[model samples]
Every structure is written in structure tokens, then in C-alpha cells.
Target: MGACVGCGGSQSPGVFVLEAGTYARCDGCGLASLDPLPAEGAAGALFEEGYFHGGVAGGYSDYDADGALHEANARARWALVERHSGAPPASVLDVGCAVGTFLVEAQRRGAQVAGVDVSPWARAQAEQRHGIGVAASVEEVAARESGEFDVVTFFQSLEHVPRPDRLLAGACACLRPGGLVVIETWDAGSTVARVMGKAWQQMNPPTVLHLMGRPSLAALLGRAGFELVTVERTSKLVSVGLVLHILADKFPALLGWLGVLARRPWLARLTLRYRLGDLVTAVARKPLAVVGT
Candidate 1:
């Protein structure tokens, strides 16, 4: 990695390796990224049905099956945005929205919600599930209207993008003056990340390019023309079913115990709240006034 996507800082590659991918760190900002990052917008083709249903290309394993957990997490994230905005947002956008799970929840709450997902299946699902018309990207949404949304969110999506800074600037362009942007991604600099070292599950690359942290993410927000508001730990409520699947994947040796847990079908619907520091959220606001345009 010669340059950082988060802050455009110079980066040194070969700092480390995690799961068959070489890692690099920004010399100026300490942002870790995949060396020779994957092509931008490459994640589009990886979001089809198989991606969500079969865990293709590091995608989810039966994403829609976790609707309860998805809705719960969505509600939590939206509540955070509301707390910062002090009210329900007039309009909201979620970038890289796989199937509008979050937007459906927002729609139920009476907010005009929109989304951007490159997958045709996801786009159709968004409209069918919640009547939310999805754009291919922020540029497509900006083509129709700039400064149109009150809030924009990147819930667990930014780290996977090849050019986070560019996408962030586009997100800023989609926001009205002083609008808020909520970004929630994994933290590579957290204590758990350090302790786990290379064993950290999120360290997967090509699928995950940037290993974002509070300082690096703050810098990314600042460079994208946003004022840093707050950074905090965001909890994810994952169903026990998903947990068992992860356990099976990571520790095959525990299959005996995992099979026991999987035998209880009710556990599939049971959700566990994880308030891990490694999962971080940052909310930023566009400036009310610009010095130059």
C-alpha cells in the first residue's frame, strides 16, 4: 500500500499478514489496509443472492434469515442517529445497503428512506421489501439531488470499499448543510484486535481493505468535509444461529459442542448483544458554511 484510502497518506506495505493477505499501515495516520487493494466497485458483483445466502466472497450466510437481528441492529443504529440529530431524520440514505433491512425499519418509523446497493437483486429486494428505491451508488443519488438527505449511514460497509475517501466525499455531497453521517465499522486498533493479533476474524482482506480505527476514521471524516461529532462502541445483536455458524467456521474442533447448541432450534431466534469495543461507530456532520465552493 503506497497510499491510504482513508486520508491519502503514504503507507508502507508488508507491515504484517492476516489470512493470506499482506497488510500495510499508513505512515502518517496509522490506517491499516490491504496491500495492492482490490479494484474499486469490485464488491458489486459479489452481492448477488449467493453472496448473502451462501457466504460467497466473504458475504453473509443467509443474511435475510437474520431479519430479527438485522432489524434490532438497525433500530439501534437509527436511534443513535436520532440522538445526534435530536429528532427523526427527514430523509435518510444507507450506502451499500444489502437488502434495505435498515431502511425498512426506518420506513416503519415514517422517514423517507433511500439506499445505494450495486446488486440488482438487492435493489429489487429493497423496493419489494420496503418500497425503497435503491441507487447504484452515491453518485447516482447525487445525479438526481444533491444536499437532499438529512442523514446518511454506512453501517458495516465502508471498510470493504477500496476508496473510502472518495465514497465519503460523495456521501458528503449527498447531505444537506450540517447533515449527519453515521459510519459503523470494525476497529483494527482495539484491544481485542491487538490481543487476537493475526487470528482476528475481521483481518480478512480483498474482502476487507481498510482496518479502520477511531483516529484514522476521524481523519477520513475530516478529509471528507465533515466535522467529527462522536465515536463510540456500537453493539450488534447477532442470533445464536449465526454465532454457532461462526463457531463452526472458526473452531471446527468445537463442532461437538456447537452441534449441541444447534440442536436447540429456538436458539436460532435467540439474539445475543455484543458491545465489543472492536465494533466502533462514528458520527460526523457537514459544516453549515463552507469557506470556498
Candidate 2:
């Protein structure tokens, strides 16, 4: 293992191994990242059509299957954004805005919203289904609308980025002064991760490149000219059927049983919202004035 990506700390072997890759933890930042990180295009490959439908190991069982549930979750996230930064930002940009669920909710709250996703299928769905402007990358959006956004979000997408520093820099460049950046990512220092150890379902390779804790994340935000506002754990609502389906992927023998339950209309519709204290939501603001400039 080399120096830590988030913080230049001495690296030691981690407790988990996935797909022949070893995860190493940094003594300085507590980020557990895959050694010999995935290739340039590996992250993009995970967002294909089969990812949402469970053809892949680290993806959702049926992402689009729970439309109402997803929209409800999106609305809840929007409420959080409003709680921290106030309602109806002048403009919002969603990085890795898969299918634009959050973008739609932001629009509903009266923000001019746009999104960018690496997956063509997702981008198309965001544009055609939600009628929101979707681009392939922040660079593309910046070409047209630089420093014009009031809020930029990375909802469950920052962990997948190979270079988070670059991602934050690009986001900062695209934001107006005092703009807010919202991030939701898995925390490596959480109790659930410590308890599960290597068996944690999220410790997979190629899909999850980095696991960031609050302190490391705050430092990253500050380096990119953002002031950390809040860091807290957030809950997500997932269906019982979806949970079973995800479990089935790891325990193949349970697939038959889980499939049966997943088909039951009532069981499939049951939703639970709980905080595992493993996921962190950090809200940061770009400094009102550039330091030393």
C-alpha cells in the first residue's frame, strides 16, 4: 500500500479482501481504500443497466422498481438540505445524479436544477424522464455555466470516485461564492463497519474505492475552500424485499427464498428507515472570499 489518498498517512494492511484486491487503512485519516486502485474507467463501468437490476455484485437489486419509495427518499434528503442551508437555492447541480431523483425533488422545491452522471443510461433517464438537463461530467457543465450554482451535491457518489480531491476541486470551481456542497458517503470509522470487519457488504472493490470518516472529510472540504457546516449520520429507507435481494447476492443459497419473498406484493412494499450510524452526511460551504487572493 502507498500513502493514503485522502491524507498522506502511513498505510497498513486492512482486514478485508475483495475480488483479489486488498483494502488498506491509513493511520492518519482512517480511510480504508483499495490498494492498487481500479483502472481509470472502472468506476464508470459499475453504473451500467445491470447495476440497478442486480446483475452486478455491488449494485442495487432493482433501483427503478421502487419509484415512490425513491422519490420519498429524495424528498427527505431535500428536507435535510433545506434544514441546513435553507430552502430553494438559486441553482443546484447534482454530481453523479443517477436517474435524477434528487434533482426532481430539488426542482419541486423551486431550485433550478441540473445533473451529471457517468452512465449514459442514467443521464438519458434523468433528461428524458425528469426533463432535467444532464451532462456527462462537471467539466462539461462548467463549460456552459461556471460558478453559477448555489448548491452542488454528491449523494452516495463521492465514495466511488477514484480521485476525490479532483472531484472537490471541480465542484468548487463550478460553485458561486458561499455555495453549499452536500455529500453523503460511508464512514469507515462507524461502529457497524468496525463490528462487521471484513464481512461488511460495502467493503467491495471497484465499486467502493474509498471510505471517509468525518475528520478526513472535513479536512478535504477545507482544502478545497469549503467551510464544514455539519457532519451527521443520515438514514435511508429501503424496502424489506430490497434488503433481502441485496443479501441474496452474497448468500446465493438464499436467492430462491428471497426471490419468493421479493415477489410478494406486500412484503416488497414494506419500507424501513433506520440510521446504522455508518453513513455520514457532510454539508460544507465555499468560503465567501478566496483566502490570500
Candidate 3:
């Protein structure tokens, strides 16, 4: 394993990237990816039991607090929605659309939104609760749903996939010409990563196989046959706080609730570090001429 998207140096490499301070930078494309990504089968288990739907959703309780999180999510949704002016396309697809938050927002804006997620629990909850269409798999959705979409979004869901290239290909396939693929992911090259080092929450191992940066991601999209039209770095204030909380919680026995008090007060210096970062949003357009790559 060397400098390839899915390739990395094998230090005792099994099937997944298992070390710290080491990454496989793709030669084909400069997208730095973690090698020995989770096994194909292991992905489902890791996602189902290890993170997301596991038990961490509660950590996002701030979202439901007095509708503050919902308000923030709605703001993000509207920002993406406003980006696409004129007419809301005929339909849209949201891959890895957990709980269909964006789907609901898109629907409210008069777009026919459908989503696909691996978790049956999330799908059922979306349909039962939100009344949206959800498929169990991308392949199943592709087969059942035809025609192209105006927009395809993968918010905070790209890094979770073991194979980002394959996932991008699939996402591109679902879009119509001139369609947009709006992606929001953690920028590993951001100041947060630079300052926090390995403690950054997005760097959580065994799950996030790729720590994408702006340049590498743009390269990956170009190679995937998409033109990077617009790139915006949005402040992920809550997410940064969440990462800090995760770090604090990891040392709960040591920090306890007083972790809020920052004993080594120099850390207070990094307080503003949270707001300065971005979620690295890129709106890549599927070429109007090319149907497939």
C-alpha cells in the first residue's frame, strides 16, 4: 500500500487502516485515504454498532434542545437550497441520508426528495415519522428510481464510507446533466486538525477511512468526471464543540464535568478555534455532456 486513495503503507496492515500518524495518499488522485479500509462486510457492522445509530445520536441532543439544533440544521438546509435558484428540480437523491433531515427540508421547499441509507432503523424512522421515501440500498434505489435528479447531497456522510470513490461514482450516476452534487465533509487539513492533532473527532479511527482536504477532494472530483464549480467553507460551530466534547468525554474519569473548566487554561486560547473552521462544502457539477465516466 502506498499513495493511492484506498492504498496505504501496510504496517501490520490487515484490511483496515490501524495506526496513528500514517495515511495513504492516493497517487492516481491526491485524495489522502486510510488504507486497509474496513472490510466490505465489516462496514455494516461498524456503522450499525460502533457509531451513528449506535448510541452517539444522543450526543447531538443539543439539536433537539429548544429546537436550536433543528434551527441550525434548517439553516444549513436552506443555505444549500438557496444555492440552487430558479426551479427546484423534478427529484433529488440523498445518499447516507440519516433520519432524512435534509429530505424533509428539501420536501418543504417543493422538491421530490427520496433517500437511501444502510440503517433500516433510520429508514423506518424517516418514513414512519417524516413520511419520506427511503430504500435499503443504493442499488435498490437506483433500480427502483429512474430519471436524473437536480441535486444529490451527502452531508457529513462521505467520510463514513469505506470506499469514497465508489460512492462518488454511484452518486454521479444518480444525477442529471448540470445536476449538482453537494458534499459536506470534515476538512482534515483545516486548522482544527492542525491544532487538535489526533484528538480531532473526525479523525476517529476504524470508521472514518478518509480524512479529505479541499485540494484532494477537488482532485478526486475532477478525476471522477465532475467539475468543481463552487467551494465554500462553512462554520461548523456545533460540530467543533462536539469534537471537543468527544475528546473531553474520552477522558471523563480525568476531566469529569469540570472538563468544561479547561484546567490547562491555555486551551482557552483555542476556544475561538472552533468557529474559524469550515465544513468544506463543494458544489460540483456533473458535466452536461458526459452521462457516465
Candidate 4:
């Protein structure tokens, strides 16, 4: 009933339906998106303090509770960036940088890092706790420092935005020549997504606006003036408590077990690092010749 976020083409109903809304796939680009879209202020409301503590739907349960696991996840992602790009960037901006965990890791690696998040709580925490420059949104960051960053990252946050193209454009506008744009997001075209269909945990509506595939993602980056570099599946190191917290949402029976595990500090701290293959990390670069173009 609405135009697709990926291609602006007519959309057909998708296989999933949640309490929030129905989803549809684009005939042209095949990106699945929520229909009717989220009300203007609705999406931002999802990132409040309640989001990290499981008070809100489609959000984590106690995101800050596992500090060591979060840092390990950030280190894994930073390793991926170094493997693909081969150097520590001079400056970096992280979009949707909740609590600045990744930016903290980037700073440890000698990158000057700034972050933007919709949640004031997150922004304040990033600035106060991590000492990173934090703002309310990418537009706000662009206003103060356009074309000033050697890297722009959207780690597991792009699909949550209502306008991904606008987000990418703002990131591109903030990058220096030959700078990189790194994205970690759900890949709807991946084997796991195809096999799991509507039951995929990433299909939560309203919170997740678009499910991007590799081809659509490439087209979007190209349109935003980035040349594709690498796109591949990436793994994360997550605590057992966090994984159980997420799974408990879809499978309520797991809650009893999760509750038991939560009381056990040793078991809760266990970390798993494995590739699920449904999520992808991509790197793209702005050409050196097109600094302002």
C-alpha cells in the first residue's frame, strides 16, 4: 500500500504481521518494510531508558548489564574494520551510538570518535561516561562538523531508521575524501533470513523499518556517492544473559530458564562468538577525487 523505502516502488504484502504493523516487500528492490510507517515521534520513543531494560518492545533487556561482553563485541567489530580497511582512521562518527561502546573501542585504537543517538539518555551517557562527542542526531552532527570524519559507522542501527537514504546521505556528507562508511545490519537476502522467513528475530516492526539486502544496500551506497568495498557476514560476542533475554521475547517458555540464568553470575557472563549469517557488515568508500562532489 506504500512505496518501498529501498526503491520507491509499489509494495506487496509480506509474510509477517506483528502487533505494531504489517510488513511488505518492494517489487523492485525486495526490501521488506513496515506499512503505514511509524508515527513521526514514535520511533524516538523506543530508545528511552526503558529500551535497554526490556520495558519497551523490540528493545534489549539490560543492555548495559554486560559491560565486558559489550566491549568484546565492539572489539570484534573494530577488528573487522581493520581487516577490511587496514588502518586506524583519524576521525570517526558513529550513528545510533547507544552508550558509545563501539566508539570507546575506536578511541582505544587511536581514532577520534564522536557519536549521535536519538535518546538523550544515550547521548549523555556517551559524553559523560565515554568522553565522546555526542549529539541527538546525524543532522545535528553534520551541522557542526560536515565532511570532517575519516569513517562513519552505523552498527546494527540502520534498519531502525525511517529514512535510510537520508541517514546515508548525512553520513556521506560528513565523510572526508576516501573515507569509509561501515554498516552492520540485517540482510534479508541471506540464507538464514530466507529459511527463517517471518520468524526471524530481526523482523520486529516499528522498531525496524527496513530489512536491507546486499543488492539494495549497494544501490543505496552508490546513490549516496560511495563505492562498494566489502560486504560479508560478521560475528559478535554476546553474553549468555543478553542472548537469552532476546530469545525470551519470541519464546516465552525460555523466560523461566533465563530468569534462572540471570541469578547465576558465572553462567550469565559466558560469551558466544559465532556467525549467524543473516547479519552482514559492509564497507564502502567515498572516492578521493570527489571530496565535495
lDDT (10s digit) by residue, model 2, range 1-32 = 77776766787885467654678877877777
- Candidate 4 regions exceeding 4 Å error are 39-41, 261-263, 290-293
Error of 1 at 262 (Å): 4.2
> All models: lDDT?
0.83, 0.82, 0.63, 0.82
Compared to the true structure, candidate 4 yields what TM-score?
Answer: 0.92
Which is superior by TM-score, 2 or 4?
Answer: 2
Instruction: Kindly provide the TM-score of model 1 when superposed on the true structure, using C-alpha atoms.
Output: 0.92
On TM-score, the candidate that comes out on top is: 2
Runs in model 3 lying further than 4 Å from the true structure: 6-22, 27-30, 49-68, 84-86, 237-244, 249-254, 258-274, 290-293
Model 1, span 1-293: residue lDDT tens: 46687777888878877555888989877889888887876777767788777465356656877877888888888789889999999899999888898888788788888899878899988888777789988899988879999999999889878889989999999999989999999888899988887666677666777888887998999999999999988789887777776666557699899878876878766778876679988999999975786
Candidate 4 C-alpha lDDT tens digits along 1-293: 67766666777895468776778878888878787677544566778889887676568766877777778888888887777667877888989899999998998999888898888778778878977768877888899889999889999888888878788989999998888999999899988888877667787876888888998798778878899998988877777766776677766777797778777878777878757887789899988973464
Model 4 has a clash total of 0
Candidate 1 ranges beyond 4 A from true positions: 252-264, 290-293
Error of 2 at 225 (Å): 2.3
Question: How does residue 131 of candidate 2 score in lDDT?
Answer: 85
